[model samples]
Target: MKAARFHAARDIRVEDVPAPGAPGPTQVLVKNQFCGICGTDLHEYLGGPIFIPTAPHSYTGGQVPQILGHEYSGVVEAVGSQVTSVKPGDRVSIQPMVSPRDDYYGRRGQYQLSEQLAIIGLSHPWGGMAEYSLVEDYNAIPMPDDLSTEHAALIEPTAVTVYATHRGGVKPGDSVLVAGAGPIGQLQVMAARAAGATRIFLVDLNDNRLEMAHRLVEGLITLNPGSTDVLREVRARTAGGVGVDVAFECVGAEAPLGLCLEAVRRQGVVVQVGMQGKPPALDGFTLTYKDVDLRGSWCYSTLMWPQVAALIASGQLPAEKVVTRHIALDDVVEQGFEALLDKAGTQLKILIEL
Candidate 1:
């Protein structure tokens, strides 16, 4: 088996490793076919050692000497006796959250927020950036035969967007604004539109990204915040300062997040879908004055994976359009992660084909 391991920040290598055996009673063994490097993976590569929950990792519970990839898809090589959801040769994508059975949060449908949660890429012995992965049966969702591995590899991130947009209560006929044009931001655009948001605005400083956003979204408008005030432009297009009815903050930067805070109309919802490096500052008075709902979204509910998969299978969301590049497992270091650092013009999801 060959695995891409994260030894520390700025370090990832594909090395020959042990092949996992057949499943345990509650587990399944998957031979991976495709994996995607995500923004979180970039954070772990650059600024982290952050959230693995073991003390032996005084620096990182296991970021170093860790198998690092979560967004992926594969075929089940074997399944344990207790695994009723899937079987041998079944193509599947994993939902990477772990939870304690006794936890009240897990029982409440908020497993994404469970205190005992451990992400597969960060805490497990093997994750998707490998030739094989061992995951619990509950984590594996069988993929429709028509779904390509690249699109299947995207189900995880697409699940995140689906979860967040639903949490924001986005509806048809609502004018929506996505305050960023990164991969997640662009997905936010697609997700918002799919969820019935009629008029959508994608705001960003990068004209290249905005252009890409425009290309991915058929009728959605792209707004250049650098050239003109974004709020003004969206409103001018929308007819008044009542502004967009809903906003999604997808860059994780205060500039875009703050713009989301100010741009949604009174009573509109603002969903925070990106990971912020720092706490964003907000005027508490605005919440009281505007009577708006500004909430943060973490990952998705396990229940959401089926719909996400269906969206991909149906081509309604066109998940493949987001895949800007494909690389072999060996080239993730430069082409997937590092390229994201310097890329513009034409890049979105970068998938590693195993």
Candidate 2:
């Protein structure tokens, strides 16, 4: 089997590797079809070993020189003896979060909040970038026959956006302000719309990404902080100049977080969706004065697979609209990663077609 393994920063190699032959008692062997290169993968490529462990991880025990990919879809080549959820020849979307042991959070049905959470591609031995990979039978959620494999691969990231909406408590006729136009930000817009948000506002420095978001999502208002006063504009356009009902900081930066805090109405909710590189400086005054609720949204719930898959399959959330390009596994580094990192910000989601 050919796999792309991360050796170090700027060093991802595509070489032949030993195949994951068979499944364990509760495992499933999947023939990977499509995989999406995530922002986490790019962070690892640039300056990492962040999530990719240098030493043995506390949970999965995976280390550096790891296979990189989590957003992917495939067909089940084989299933283990105890696996009854899926069988051979079933098309599935891989829910990569692995909580090998029961914990307080897991006991509460919040597996993603478990302290020893391990992701499939980042910390687990097998990943979807390869032709074949082994996963727990529970990780493989069977897909609907009408869903395309490309769309199936998107279920993972869509889960993130959907969970963010849930975390923000976005309701029908609510107004939403998303402070980023990246891939996740674009998906945030779609998720907000599907959650029945009547008005959606997006802010980003990159005009290209803002244009892409406007084109992909209907009735989206885009704002570039570089040219316009985002806070004033957002407040003016919102109901009674109070501000949006909910605001999401998707850029993971100090400025965007500040924007979200100030743009949201008093007593409104603000969900932090992006992974911040460092602890951002907080405006305690605004938080205290407005009585705003600031919350952090991590990964999706372990049980969100079925609901997310249904949303994408039904076209309520057009996950495919964010896909800018698709390349083969061999071209992942140059065409996929490099293309995404381009300063022009033209690309969004780049899928690796196996």
Candidate 3:
């Protein structure tokens, strides 16, 4: 089997590796069809060992030189004796999260918040970038026959945005302000719309991404801090000069976080959907005076795979709209990862077709 393994920063190699032969009981062996390179993968390529463990991970025991590709779709090549959710020849999207131990959070059905969380591809031995990978039966959620493999690969990332909306408590007729127009941000707009947000505003420094967001969602208001005063523009559009009902900070930066805090209406919610590199300073005054609710949205719930898959399959989410390019596994580093690394780049979700 050929796999792309992360050796170190800027060192991802495509080479032949020993194949994961068979599935263990309660596991599934999948022949990967399509995989999407995620922002986490890019961070590892640039300067990491962040999530990719340098030592043995506490849960999965996976170390560096890890295979990378969590957002993927594949067909079941084989299933273990105990597997019942899926069988051979069934197409499915990989859920990626693996909860090895029954922690307090896992016991409560909040597996994503488990203290010893180990994600497939990042901390687990097998990953979607390869031709074949192994996953627990629970991680392989079968897709509808009408769904394309490319769309199925998008389910994982879509889960992130959907979970963010859930955390923000987005409801019908509410307004939303999303800061950052990257792939996740674009999906946030769609998810917010699906949640019945009537008016949506998107802010990004990159005009290209803003334009992409506009095309993805009809009637989206895009603001570029470069030209437009985003805070002023957003407030002006809202009723009574009050800000949006819910604001999401998808850029994972101080400025964007600040923008989200300032752009949300009084007593509104601000969900931090992006992974911040460092602890960002919060405006205590705004938080205290405005009675704003600041919340952090990590990965999606372990049980959300089915719901997200259905949304994509039904065309309510349109996860496929974010896929900007497709490349082979051999071209993942140059064409897939590097293309997305370009700040002025037009690429969004670049899928590696195996």
Model 2: lDDT equals: 0.92
Q: Clashes in candidate 3: how many?
A: 0
Candidate 1 per-residue lDDT, tens place, 174-197, comes to 889888788788877888878888
The parts of candidate 1 lying over 4 Å away from their true place are 53-63, 343-345
Q: What are the per-residue Cα lDDT tens digits for candidate 3 across 95-200?
A: 9998854678877888888878889999999899999999999899999877888899999999999999999999999999999888899999999999999899
lDDT values, one for every candidate: 0.82, 0.92, 0.91
Residue pairs with colliding backbones in model 1 are none
Candidate 1: how large is its RMSD?
2.1
Candidate 2 ranges with C-alpha deviation above 4 Å: none
lDDT (0-100) at residue 37 of candidate 3? 91
TM-score against native, each model: 0.95, 0.98, 0.98
Error of 1 at 33 (Å): 0.7
Error of 2 at 128 (Å): 1.3
When sorted by lDDT, best at the front, the candidate numbers are 2, 3, 1
